[model samples]
Target: MTPIKDTHPSASSAVESGAPGARVGNFRWVICGLLFFATMINYMDRQIIGVLKPQLSHELGWTDTGYANIVSAFQLAYACGYLFGGRLMDRFGVRRGLSWAAFLWSVAAVAHGLVRTVLGFSIARLGLGLAEGGNFPAAIKTVTEWFPLKERALATGVFNSASNIGAIVCPLTVPLLAAKFGWPAAFYITGALGLGWIVAWALLYDSPETHPRLSVAERAYIEEGRVVTTEAAAPWLSLLRFRAAWAYMIAGLLAGPVWWFYLFWLPDFLQKRYHLTLQQTGVRVGIVYTMAIVGSIGGGWLAAKLIGRGWSLNAARKTSLLVCAVCVTPVFFAASVENSWVTVALVGLAAAAHQGWSANLYTFVSDTMPKRAVSSVVGLGGFVSGIASMGNAQVVGYVVTKTGSYALIFAWASTMYLLSLLAIQILVPKLVDARENERRVVTDDGTSV
Candidate 1:
């Protein structure tokens, strides 16, 4: 990977360029909004099962091991899908890739309503996982295409916060939906919502240069100083040779499980630990995810703010990550806390910090890689994360069964971010863009080759 300097026009330059008739339309933000909604729907579909875990467990007579297996099946399929989905997006572009992914996942989400046995649910979840794996890769790639380096993190955070939004929306609505229409309707409603997003996405999304609605000034602003690569997008396998890829993959491996633990186990934890009903658990889970939304946006903004103050990208991003890591340490004490609300506060802080860490980590791909390769690299990382999450699912299920306690799981969650940070530091010592140093040879006539 080559290190590239950003030559894009500065914010002041963009403002100056938008003179007279050159209106700098803020259409990029409109695209960001679309990505946000897609992600919110993506997560809501996945989170519904977790929110309804107690009801599902009781209804199906599932043991801890059985539930873990269902989750593990999804993770296994998600791992495979992440590898392929990222590459598919790179080859096919976001418009087609995301549309297909959303449609398939939506179908799978609805299929869950028809399943009765654990095996049947596992099959449905596997399908959901396979399709949902494409979401982040496509979203991250879209951000890289539409936003300049300075704004990519904030764009990523803005869209990424949608995951928490989806999580929040799940609890807020799923319980009520299940109560009113039965559990199957919860799946049907969330599943059907994606169909609408799919139609809107197909109608609205396109590359900035190709978008008819984009103004010339806005397109130029987006393209200015971006490294123009003529080489074909790097193969997914080639990304592994770069240390930056390893940094991202390792960080994902360590941190992905923590999020999975929260997503899959948190509601069950509330029910078993505090004896909360479904409605109460939903409210509490919504609160935790709401905090995560704050962290996701705040984390991204903090790094951008630091960059504006002349901090190195490395310093700015890593500093934000370190602060997030420290915030998570308090969660270790959560398992020991006596008051349920205190436990919620501690876990909430940790969840928020994880989102903050994730925002920076996702930005690292866009900051370091060529736009053409961003999706592939992100896919590689997600593939690793999916595998790790699969293992964690099994471990969590087994440990909880044997010990009948969440203490060990909470202890492990608190340490992952710091270790992930260390791996990132070792692998990517400087947050440098890989294409920075490449020189495009020109003929004597000043014509590019």
Candidate 2:
């Protein structure tokens, strides 16, 4: 996709134009709130299937491999959509780009209710996967357009936490809805919420440059940070050459599937291991995702607090990631624990840590890339991760079907973050803020490295 010629002010130019006024209004926060709702809907819609899997399998008589094929359909489509969606955002801008994506995905969510066979569900999920791919790339672009560097991570964390909220909504409510009204009702109801989000987004959102409701002071406040970058947005292929970009992809490769497993398989795990029904797994899974909400917001808050107090950007970000990695190691015991709550504690801690790790991971794009390039990089990283996640889902299905054990998967998930962290350290060596540098470092091959 060709990049659109959208004019945007760098922080340096805006700061040069005028000093920020006192007592800034928080219209920017209104935008953040909207993003939170959009993310919440996005996760809730994708996860509805996972919540209904046990019932669906029984009703339709799906084999493990059959269910995995459905998941793989979504993952494959999701990877393709993610790769292209970023460029589409860069080409079309958020208002137009995100609205259509959210709309189409909502339609896909509703479509799930009409399907009865394995092939039908896979087709529906493919549509959902393709449409939902644009969600985060657009959200990150919106943040870069609206918030200054100092508050960007916090804004990301706040919006990112909505995924936890969505996860919470599904397990807590999907099973109940299915029990009362049938599984179709669960998809129909959640998909309708996207209509409300579309209305709010169309009416409320605009870039800071043109937002009529935003105060001039708030506009100044949003542009106060120094945004250093190359003279222009980096071309997509050139960006592929950077170690920073690959570091992000590597991190996604390792961790994205683990998160995906939690999203799609946790209900099954809870059910098989404990012989819990959909409703029982609902309560237990709800508790697990509730803890994740804390990680999403708290992780960002901790790193932001550190930066505000004088830690280097690198130190704050990496230390927080390291802390998350260590917390996840406890998951080694998650599948083996006898007490269900004990297992919840171990898995919950890891789930929470994953979100925290995710918050910082997303911020890496905004911190290191120009505002113009942020979505594209985030999209590419997601594409890589989505591909890995596809294989992960299929393998998980096969393993569980053959072995009837979760211990191996949990053990695999436990080590990913440490390896991800190691890749980030080795590839990035030091975090480079794009706002402070004019060009990416390049190797002798003339590629940015």
Number of the predicted model whose lDDT against the real structure is largest: 1
The TM-score between candidate 2 and the true structure equals 0.93
lDDT of each: 0.87, 0.86
lDDT score of model 2? 0.86
Q: RMSD of each candidate?
A: 4.0, 3.7
Instruction: Please list the residue runs of candidate 1 whose C-alpha ends up more than 4 Å from where it truly belongs after superposition.
Output: 1-23, 437-449
Candidate 2, residue 395: lDDT: 95
Error of 1 at 13 (Å): 5.3
- For candidate 2, write residues 40-158 as lDDT tens digits: 99999999888888889999998889989999999988987887888888777899999999999999999999989998999999999999999999999899888887788889889
Writing each residue's lDDT as its tens digit, candidate 1 over 154-213 gives 898899999999999999899898888999999998889999998899889998868998
Error of 1 at 255 (Å): 1.0
